[model samples]
Target: MPRNRATASPLFVPRKATRTQQRVARAEFAKARTKARAAQAPSRRREHEGADPELQPSYPASGRPGPASARGGRLRLPKHRMTTAVAGGAYPFLAEAGLGAEGIFIGRDLHAEGSFCYDPFALYNSGRIEGFTNPNAILCGVIGMGKSALAKSIATRAIAHGYKIYVPSDPKGEWTGLAEALGGQTIALGPGLPGKLNPLDAPGRPTGVSEEDWTNEVRKRRLLLLASLAATVLKRDLLPMEHTGLDVALDLVVADAEATETVPLLGDIAHVLGNPERLDAALGDQAGGLGRAADDLAHAFRRLVHGDLSGMFDAPSTVAFDPAAPMLSIDLSRLGSSGDDTALVLAMTCASAWMEAALADPAGGRRWVIYDEAWRIMRHVGLLERMQQQFKLSRGLGIANLVILHRLSDLLSAGDAGSRGRVLAEGLLADCSTRIIYRQEPDQVQVSMSLLGLTGVEAQAIGALTRGRGLWKVAGLSFIVQHLLHPREKPLYDTDFRMTA
Candidate 1:
C-alpha cells in the first residue's frame, strides 16, 4: 500500500535520526558558521584600523606603568609629602570663605587669598553687620607701624567714591599737604599767625529748620564752646555757678549780636563776663553773682585773646570753611611744637566748632571726620565730650568719625581710674564697631585682647604683625590683612619723613 501510494501521489516521507547521526549533523553546521565568521574578521579589522586608540578595546597587560612594579602585585598611588600645617591648610574644609567682596578695597585677606574691602557706611546700609547702627571706627597701632598711612589710604581712597574728609585737627600738620593735593583747603593756625577762628560763629543752617530752632542751636553751641574753652584752660570742669555765669554771658553776647547784626567773637563773650553791670542789665535779677562767678571764665578766655594763644580764635575766622571742598584740614603744627598742649587743644576745639557749622547743613553730604592724634584730644574733657556727642549722632549726621591712636595705653591714660573722662574715653571705643589693630608691643597684648575681645590666636598674632599688616574686626567677623599701598601715596602719607631725611 505504501509503494502504491508513493507512486500514485509522488510524495516523500522522513524518519527520525539516531543520536550519533544528529550530533554529526550539528557539528557540521557549527563548522560551516565558524568558517563564515572567520572570513569576515579581516574585513571588520580593516574598517576599524583608523579608530581612536583610546576608543579601542583595552586588554590586560603583563605590567601596569606606574610607581609599582609587576613584582609588587597591586597598583599603588604615590605618597604625598607635606608638613602638618601645610596639609591642614590644603584641606578646603579648614578654610574660610572670606568677607564677601563688597566695599572699599583695603588690601588683601592673607588667609582667604582675596581682596579685603571695608566701608563703614556701605556695610551699615547693606546690613553686612548685625545690630551695628553707627558708622564709626577705631584705628590703633604703635607709631611708625603704618597706622597713619592706613588712615590716609582710606581717606584718599574714599574720596574717589564721592566721600568728603574733614580733618578737624591735624596736630602734626600731616594732612595739610594731602588736603592741598586733594584740591581741598587747609587752615593753618598758630601764634602770630593771621588765621583766626570764632567758635561762636553761627553754623550754616539746614533747610526747613525754624528760626527758633536755629537760634536755640546757635545759643547752645556758643554756651558749650565757652564752657569747653574755660574747662580746657582751667583743666577742671566748670561748676554749676560757672555754667550759669557762662549762660548769662553767652546770652548777652548773642543778644547784642542780634541787635548789631554782627557775629560775636570770643572777646565779646569775655568782655561781657568781665562787666557785671552789662550782664545784670541784660539778665536783670537773674544775673545774681553771675558776673563775679564768670570772672574765672572771662580770665580763661582772655588768654585766648591776649595771651600766648592770642591772634587765633579771638576774632572772626580769617579762612572760610568750604564744605564743598574735597577735604578740609586745620593745620595746628605751629602750636603743636609750642610745648603747650593746651594751646594745641584750644586750636583743635575752635577748628572743630567752625567746621561743625558747615556740617550742620543737612545738605552737607557724608563726611569722614578724622580725629588724628586722638589720644592728645581725648585727654581734654571738653574734646572728649564733643567726641561722644559726635559718636552718638554719627548715623543721623551722615558722618564717620575715625579715632586714631598709638596704643591702647593711650586710652588708659585718658583719665584717672573710674573718672568721667575715663568712662567717656572708653565709651568712644565702644561706639566704634570697627576696630583695626596693627602690630602691638607685647605689653599691650592683654589690654588689646580684653578690650577688643580677641581670641588667643588673634591676640598673639597682633603682637607679631609686621609693618602694613593689621587685624581687622568688624561686627563679629575678623581678618588678618596685609595693607597694600599705592606708590604715589607713600610720599603723601609717610610719617617717617624726618627719620628718612
Candidate 2:
C-alpha cells in the first residue's frame, strides 16, 4: 500500500446500497407507476369504446403464423389415449353418423365403414334428407362396371319389399330370365314371333278417376303414342295438318273398335289415313287439306303395319298385363337386326306406351320403371319428350323411374347444348332425387362432377371406385358405397356368364 495515495474522501466515494434502502426505493417507484396507470385507464377505455371495429387492431385465431398468429405453429398434443366410443365424441370429424337402418340394405359405407342402405320411397317419406323431392333415381357408369348388376339387384330385392318392378323396354332381352324366374311376364316380339302388343290397349282405370275422365285420358295417351311413332318413322315431326289427320283417324278407329267390342289396331288408323276422302269428310269444313296432309302420315304408319315391322304392334295384344306380377319386362330381343336401331326404337316405343298406360293407374301401388339401355332412346327427340312427361308425372303416378345410363355424357349425346333433346335429357336428370355413380372413364369425371356437383375429394374418390362400388348421392349428401351382392344373386345377375362359359 505504498504511498496509500491520499485516502479517497468518503464523501466522493460511492457506498454500496443497503438491502433495506433498495426495498424502500422500489416500493415508492411502484406506487408512483400504479398511480399513473390508474389515471390513464379511463382514457384508454373511452378510446377503445369509440374505436371502429374495422380500425381496431386484429388478432385472428387462424392464419399465417406470426407474432399476432393464434400460434399456428407445430402443435404437439399430449399422448393421451381414449376408447374409440369416447374418442368419437372428442373428435367428431374422424367418425361420421350414417343414414339410419331403413329400406333395402344396399352396401357398405366407406366413410363410416358401416352398412349402407337405400330406398327412395323410404327416404322420401322419412323427411330426414333435406332437398329430397322425389323417389326417382339415376344410375350412371361405364359398361362392365356393375351398373346393370346393381339395377338388377335393386329390382330383385325390391320385390321382397312388396314393390312391383317394370322394365319398359329390354332390347337386349337380358331381363327375360329374371322375369321368368320371378314369376313375372316377358313379352318377346319380332317377325314370326307371334308375340304382338297393341300400344293402343287401354289400361284399367284408376280408382279415383271418373269414367269420362279416364276415357279422355286414354284418348290423349293414344294420340301421344301415335305422334311419337309417326315422328320416329317419318324421321321428322308431323306437320299441324298431319297431326289433325292423326287426331281424326284415331277418333274414327277408337269409335269403331269400341262399337265392335274389339281393341284398336295400328292398321285401322293407317287405313283411315290412306283415304283422303275419309279424313277430309271427318274434318267437315276444315277438311280442305287434312287428307293430303295425312299422306305422309299414312306411309309412316304403314311401316308399323304392312312394312318390315309387320305383325308387331299392329294387331290386338296377345298378352294381358298382369300388374300383380312381381316383375314385368318387355323382351324385344327377337326384333330383327336391320343394321339400325330404328326397329328397336319403334318396338321400345310401343312397349313403353303399353306398359306406361298400365302404370298410369294410381292404384297400381309402388313400382319401379327401369329403362335399361335408355341411351338408344335418348337420341330421338320425340322419345325424349315422351319420357320427360313420364318423369314429371312419376310421383303422382305412385312409381319411381330408375334411368340407367352408360355415362352422364350420354345425355349430352341426346343433342348439342341447349337443343330440345338436350333440354329433355337435362330435365330427366333434374327430376331424379338420387344419383348413383359407378366408376367412370377418365374423360367422364369432369362431366360427372359438373352434373352431380361433386367436390374435389368426391371427384377423386369416384375415379378410383372398384367394380360394384358406387358413389350414391341421395339428395345433397354423399356416400362412397360398395354394392354387396348376395351369393344367390350372383348367378341371376351374372352378365359375364357368356364369357365365363
Candidate 3:
C-alpha cells in the first residue's frame, strides 16, 4: 500500500511534525555510539577522527545511526543475558587494567591477557597498593597445581634483582637442585650425614652495632632457641623459673666457648642444663636451687644433643655462613620421614634459628625466606611462634617469606579455634599481605573462601582453575594469572618427571 509522505523522524508522523524531533533522535544515536567507542581500545577510539573524503563512504558506517535498519524496520540488538565474566571475551577491552609491567614477570593475566609481574619488595616500596603493608606472602594450592613451580620462578627470577633466597628448611629437598643451579649453597642434614649446624653460633656483628650490644643480642637469640625447643618437646610453655634456668645455662656455655676460642654447640648448652648445680652456681648470689627447675628443660634439649635427633645440630657447623651467598637451604628430606614429625619439627627449629641469625643483618640486601611445606610446621605452637617472629620482622629485615601449603584448611588444623596454635596460624596469615591461590578441589572452595575472605564468585573461580594458573590477591586487589614457564625452566621446575617418564 502506498502511504502519504512521512516525517523524517517517525514513520507515522503528522504533516505538522517539527524538524526538532528528527534532530533529537539523531543526537541520541550519536551519543550512544560515542559511548560504545569510548569503552574500546585507545587505538580504536582514535579511528573515529579525521575522515578522508576520497575513501570514506558517502553513507554512514554499519549499524548506521539512523531511525531504521536497512531491512526497512527499526534497528534492534537481540537482547541476551550472560555473566560479565563470560561477556568479557566479546568485550575484551573491558577487563582488569592489571598490575603494571614491573618486577618479576610471572606470566599472563588471564582477564587482561597482558603480561603479569610480581615482586613483594617492589610492590611494598611502590606504595601503589594500599593495605599492602607487609612484604610477606603465602601460597596455597592442591597437589599438581604448579605452586612449587611458581615459587621457584619467583626465587629464580628474583636473583636478577639483587635479592638473596634462603630456604630455611626444605622438607622435600627439591630446592637443592635449584639452589645449586643458582650458584647457592645447600646443606643436607640427616643421621650419619657429615653436615652439622650449631644454632648457638653467633652471626658477625652488623657494621654499626657496638660489641657489647652484639654479645647481648646473641645471648637473647640463644635463649629464645632453647626456650622454643623446650616448649616444642614438652608441649607447653616454659615457666619463669625454667626460663631463668635456660638463661643461666646459656651464659655459662657462651663464656666457656669464648674462653676456649671455639664455636658454641647445642651439646654444650644441653650439658649445662643437665647439671642444675652448675646452672645454679653460674647465677651466683642472684639465685639458688635452680637445678630442679631445669631438670625437665634438660630432657628437652637432650633430644637434640644425645637422642635420636643428635649429630645433626649438636656439632659445630661444617660450613661457614656466606653472607653474600645468593641462596642457602638446609635439606632434611631423608630425616623425619616417619609418621611422627617431632624430629623433623625439631630440626626445622634449629636450622631456622641458624638462618634467622645470619639474616638478622638489615644490610644483607633484600632476601626471600621460602618456608616450603609450611603446613607440616603449623601444628606445633612453638614452630608457629618462631615462624611468627620471622613474619613480624620481615619488613625490617628486608625479607619476604613465601609460605606454601596444600590447602587453606591447613591453617585450621594448626589447633582448635581460640587455641594458641590457631592464634599463631591466623596471625601468620594476617601478616602476609599477598596470597596466591591455585586450583582447589570442590570441597576446598569453602575453606579457601572463608579463610581468605573471598567472595562466592571468587571461590567458584578457584575450584575451576586449571594447572599453572592462580588467583593472586595483592593487598585487597585480585588477579587471575596463568603461570607461564620458560623452556629452560621447564627442566628445572618440573616435579613430574617420574610419572611422565
Candidate 4:
C-alpha cells in the first residue's frame, strides 16, 4: 500500500474549488437572513400618506377615461405603467388626467348670500361644495336671517344644474310661487284632498261638490295628523291618567261615526282644559297655552275625519309638474294666513303631493325638497323623520330633502331629550353631505361648529356671517367656500299673481 501512494490522487487539489465552496456558503446565509427579516416585519402595505388605495383617482364613473384603443392617435402607457394614485403621488405628466365638468363644488367662498338673485350661475358654480360627495345638506339659521331665501336660491341653482326639488311648503304658499317660477306643479293634500285627479269625479257627474270641498278636506286631514302628533306628545309629558283627553276624544269620534261627534269632544276639552292657568301649568311657562290648543285641535280632527264632510280627509290632491316648464309656484296665501290651521293644511298637502310625485318618478333627475321655517308644523307631525328615511331609501330614485330650521334643538319636538331626536338630526345632516350655516347667536354657532367638526376659525365664521353671507361645506371635498348674497329678484313676492320672480 505504501508503494502505490503516488498513483492515488490527492484528496483536495484545486484552489478554484475551495473559493467557490466558500462563496456558496456565504450567499446561502445572506438569503436566510433576508427572509427572516421579511417575516418579522408587519404585513401591511407601506402607508406614507393618508390616501385610499381603492378609490379611483377621479370623479364619478361618468368621468372615467376611455381605454387605450379608444384613444385613437394618443400615445398610450404600457399595461404595467398604469400605476394608481395609491403609489404615493400625482399621476405622470403623460398620464390621462380627468378634470371633467360633471361634479358639484363645495368649499370656502367670499360671496354674499343675496347675490344669488343677480348671479345665480356664478354663485352655484363657485365651487363652495361638492354635491356628488354628500347629497344631503342642512340650512340652519335663526329667524329672520333669510335662511328661507338662501335655501330657495340654492335650490334654484340645483335645478339649473339638472336636479329635481321637493320642499315642504310652510303654510302651503311657498310651493305655489316656487313651482310657477321653476315650472313645477303644485298639489295640495291633507285630510280631505285626494292627491290624485280622478276622471270619475269630473264636474258634471260629480255630485255638485265644489273645489272648496277639496281644499276643506286637505285642511281636515292636516288637523288630524297634527292632533295625533300633539296628543302623543302630551300623553308623554302632561297626561295624569293612562286614558288621556285625546284618547277619550278618539274613542268618541270612532264610536259615534259622525262628524258632529268631534264638536262635543272639542267642547269638552275647551270647557275643561281651556282654563288658561291649567294649560300653562301643564305645558310649563316656556310651553305657554299649547296644551289647550292641542286639546281643541284633537277634537277638531276627529270631527273632521268622521263627519259628512269626511271628504276633507280623503287624502291629498296632486299637482303634476311639467318637466319642460321653467318654474312653478304654489300659492298658500290663498289657502290662509301663515300660522293658522289653513296654512298648516296647505303646507302638509303640498308636502304629501311632492313626496308622492318624487316616489312615482324614481327615474327622474335629482330632485330636492327644501323646507323653510320647518319648525312651524314639524312640531305637530312625524313627517320630518318620515321624509328623512324616505330620502335615504330614495338615493337611487334621485330624491333628496333640505330642511331649514332656526335651531337644532327644535328636533326635540319630534320626541324627547331621552329620545334620539338630536342624534337623528345629526345623522340626517351628516347624510346630506352639504351644509350652509349662516350667522347665528354664539350658542347656535357653537352647536353648529361642533356637529360639523370645525375649528375655532370656522366656528367664528358661522357666527360672524351676515344676512347675505354664510359658511358652506360640501362633504368629501377639500375646500370650504364662503357664499355671498344673491341678487334680489324684481318683486320677489306679489299679492295679485302670487310668486313673481
Candidate 5:
C-alpha cells in the first residue's frame, strides 16, 4: 500500500544523462587526462637538461619529508659501498675498530671542529706518513700566519724525534732560541763569517782550516750566488761547469773580476755571444752563448772571491747545512734585504748547500727540503723544473721535496700553462698521496674543491672555513678540519695572508 502511494511522487526525479551529454563529459575527462600527462612528463619537454634532484625545490614542511627527517635525524650514514671508502669514526677510531685509517685520516674531535690526526708507526714503517718520506715540506703563507712558528714547530718535533735540522737564519733571531728549545746544535755559516754555534749544530771535527779550504768554501758560495742569478736571468737551468767549454769562459771573467775587483752582469757579454741553445744543446755544440755565459760566470766568481763584489755577500746572511739535521730553514730576515735579490741569494745558497750535503752522504736515511715562499726564489732563480727534477729522483736518493706556493699562476709564469710541464708537477703532487688544502678564494677554492668531487654539504663547509682551517685530501678521502698553528710562526692574518686572502 505505501509503494502504491509513492508511485506518482517522483515525476521530476532526474533521468540518466543523454548519450550526447555523456559523450561530451567523456571528451572533457579525456582532455583533462592528456593535460595531466603533459605536466608530469618533464623529460619529454626538455632536452639536454639533466634531472638534478638537488635543484628541486624543497617541499613545504607540510607537503613532504626530507631524507634526514624521514630517517629520524640519524646522521650516521651507512657503510660506503666500496671497501676502500672510509667509514664513520675518529681518525684513531678507524685503526682501533680494525677498519684502519692508515693513509690519511680526516676526522672530527669532540668539539665538532675538524683536525688531521695521523697514527704513530715505527720509523722503518714505509706506510707511515711520518719521517718525511718525501724529504720535502713546504710551509707557505703571507706574513704573520705563523709560517716561522710552523717551521719552528716542525723543526722542534723532528729534532726531539732525533732528526738533524739545518737552519739558514735571518736577523729576526728566531733560530737562536731553536738550538736550546729543540736540543739540536746550530752553527752559522755565511760566506766567510762564523758566529756563535747553537747547541743544535751537528757534531763534526773542523773539516779543515787551511787557506785552500777557506778559499774553496768562499768560491763555492760565490759561484752558487752567481749561478742562481744567471739562471734566473736566462730563464733556464745552467749546465754544470764540468761538461762544457764554459769553464774557461768563467775563468776569464773570474780573473777579470779579481783584477778589477767588481762583479759585472753576465748580460754585458750578450753581444759577444748571442743566446745559445740550452745546456744540452750547448754540450752538443763546441761554441755558443753557453760558452760565453760560462766565461762570464767565472769572471763574476773571481770578482766575488776577492773583494770586488763586497756588498753582494754582505747581507748579514748565514746558512746551516747538515745531513744530520731533520729540517732546514733558511732565514731571510737577517739578510737586511727582503726583495727578490735576497730571495735569490738565499735560494742559490741553500740549493748549493743541499747539493753538497747530498753528495757528502751517499746513503742518508732521507733528506727533505721545504721551500716556504717558493715564488721568492723562483721569481729570479729559474729553478722550478730543476727543483721538480730533484723531487722526481729524490725517493731514489732518500730525498724528498715539499715546495710551497701561494698561487698556481706562479708555475704558469715559469712556462706555458698548456705545456705538460704542469703534468709533471701534477705527477709530483699525485705521488705525494697526502695533501692539505686550506681556505682559498673563489677562483682557487672552486678549482681546488672541484678536484675532490665534494658533495653539496662538504663544498659548503670548505667555502665557509676560516683562517687556519681547511679541507684535507689524502689518498682519496676529504674533510674539513681546523689546523694547529705554531707559536713561533707569526699569525697568518696579515693583509695578504694566504688563507683568508
Candidate 6:
C-alpha cells in the first residue's frame, strides 16, 4: 500500500505551485541562506584576527607598509620623472639663507628675495657672524657708482638710531648738506673761515677717570698728534731727538695749562719747541740737541699755525665740540684748492685729535668714524698709522671706522710693495671683515679679487654691477644687494646732479 501511495504522489505532484505556496517556499529559502552567512561571518573574522602575535606580519619602525602578504599589501606608486631644474625650486640647496634682518635696513638682497641690513655693532654684539670681531668696513667703487650715496644713507639712517657720526675731514665738502640735514653741525675750516681747532686741547675725560689718568691721556694724545703731524709733514718718522723734543714741549704746554687751568694751543707747543731753555729745565742735562733736533719739528708746527696751514687749527677752537651732538663733520673743502698734501694731512690729524677727545668718554656709546676719500688719507704714512691705531682699538673705544675708496689698488699705492706703509694699509683692509664692492673697471677686477679673496663668480660680478647695486661680503658670507633710497633721500644722496642738470 505504501509503495502504491508514493508512486501516485510523485506522478500527481504539480509542476507549478499556487501563489501562497510559492511565497512560503521563497521565505524559507531566504531564512536558510541568512543562517548560513551568519555562521560563516565569525569564521572569516577569526581568520583575520586569530594570527599568532609573534608570527604576525611586521611593519618597519617608520610605520611604512612592509612587503606583500597573502592577505593584503600597500598600493604601488608610479615613478615620477622631473628635471633637476624643476625640482630645485621645490628643494633649494643652492639658495643663500641671507643675513638675518637686524640693524639698519640698507636695501634688498637680490639673491634671497628679501631686505638687506647691516650694523657692525649689532653684528659684533650678536656674535652671529664668526671671524668678524672687528666692526670696521671698507666700501670700494668707481666714481658715480653710489659709494658716497651708500655712505650717506648709512650715516643718516644711523643718526635716527642714536649712533653718532664723526667725519674727521670732508675734503670735498660732500657732507656739509647731509650734516645740516641731520640737525648736526659742520665746522668749515679754510683760509677765511673763523673755525679753529687746537690739537693740544685736552679731551673731555670719561667719567670715573681720575684727574691723573685724564691728564696722562691728554698728554699722550697730544704727543701722538704732534709727532704724527711732524712725521707727516717731514714725510718720515720722527727721530729719537725729535720724539724727545716733542715729548718735552707737549709736557711743558700741558703743565702750563694744568697750572693755569686753561687749554693750550698749537702755537704754545711751537713756542716751547723754539725755546729749548724750558725743555732743558724740564729734562735737566738729558736734553741733548733737543732744541736743534726740533728745528724741523718747530718749522712744521709753524707751517700749521702761522704758515700756509694757518687760520684753521692754529689757535684754540672757536667752535665748541659738543660731544652731545649727533654728528660732527670738519669741512676741509676750503683747503682743497691749496693742493698741498701736507695741509690736508695736518687738517685730518687735528680733526682726529679733536674727535679722540670725545671718543675717550666710555659713555659716548657706539659711534662711526668715516674716512671718506680714504684713498687720499691712506697715502700719508702718519695718517695711515693713526688709522691703524684706531682700527686696532676700535672695539675698546666703542667705535667703528668706515673707509670709502675707489679701488683696492689705492691701498697698494700707499707705499712701495712690501713697505711698512703698504703692509699697514693692507692690514687695515684685513681688519675690515665687511667689504662692500660696487661696480669696478674691468682692469681692477684682478686687484679686487686678490685683495678681497673673492671667488671667480664674485670677481666677475664686480664689473657688471649697476648703480646702487653692490656685492656685500660680510664676514665670509656673500650677497648682492640693490641699495634702496627714499624719495626724500634722493635729493640728499644724489651725486648725478650735474648730469641730470
Deviation of model 4 at 448, angstroms: 2.1
Clashes of each: 0, 0, 0, 83, 39, 0
- For model 1, give the 10-residue run with minimal summed lDDT: 5-14
> Model 5, range 1-501, lDDT digits (tens) per residue?
242222233222224546665555556656766787678558543632575857654543344543535555556677646232243443432322221433223234223333445322221254533323443443333344344444444445544445445443333435655555444444433333353222111122234445676556445443444455444434456766522434333444445656886543333222112333434353564553354445544443343333323333333233444555454444444334434364435334543444433333435554444455555434442354446555566556554444555543444444454554555454445455445444444465555545445556555654556655545443444544455644443332122444563
Better of 2 and 3 by lDDT: 3
Per-residue lDDT for 211 in model 2? Answer: 98
Return the lDDT, model 3, position 431: 96
Candidate 3 local Cα displacement, residue 380, angstroms: 1.2
Model 6 ranges off by over 4 Å: 1-94, 287-291
Please tell me which predicted candidate would have the highest lDDT against the true structure.
Answer: 3
Q: Rank the candidates by lDDT, best first.
A: 3, 2, 6, 1, 4, 5
TM-score of each: 0.80, 0.81, 0.81, 0.49, 0.52, 0.80
- Name the candidate, 2 or 6, with the larger TM-score value: 2
Off by over 4 Å in 3: 1-94, 285-288
lDDT, candidate 6, residue 360? Answer: 70
User: What tens digits encode model 4's per-residue C-alpha lDDT throughout 1-501?
Assistant: 343222232332234446655555556656766787578445322332356756534433334333533544667687765343432134322221212234333222332211112122232346443454435566777765667666666666667777666654545355566666666766553344454321111111123445687435433443344343444333333343323444344333333434553222232333333343544554455533445444544444344344322333233333444544443333333333434453354345434544443344445555665666666545543455555555576555555667777765555455565564545555566676656676778877666666677767677777766664566554532122344333443234222343434
List model 1 lDDT by residue over 1-501, tens digit each: 453232233222224545555555556656766788689768767766998988865532434433354575576799989764474457532234455566678898887677888888888888846756678999998888888888888899999989999988988889988988999988888877788787777877788999999989878887888888899898888999888878878877777888999888888888887887776676677635455777788789899888888778878778777877999888888874556588888887888888877787756888899988888977787888888887887888899999999887788787897998899989988899888999889999999998888888889899999999999888676788999998999889877878873
The CA lDDT of each predicted structure is 0.81, 0.85, 0.86, 0.48, 0.44, 0.83
Of 3 and 6, which scores higher on lDDT?
Answer: 3
lDDT score for candidate 1 against the true structure: 0.81
lDDT of 6 by residue, 1-501 (tens): 343332234223233556665555556656766788689768655655866868654543334432344336566689998664565455442345566777889999887778888899988998877788789999999998899899999998998888999899898899989989888899988888888887766766777989998878777887888888888778777889889988888778877877998878788888998887777778887645465777888888888878888777767788887878888898988875555577888888888888777677768888999999889887887788889988988998888999999998999988899998899999999999899999999999999998888999899889899999999998887889999999999998776788873
| Model 6, position 410: C-alpha lDDT score | 91
Clashes of 3: 0
lDDT of 3 at 28: 63
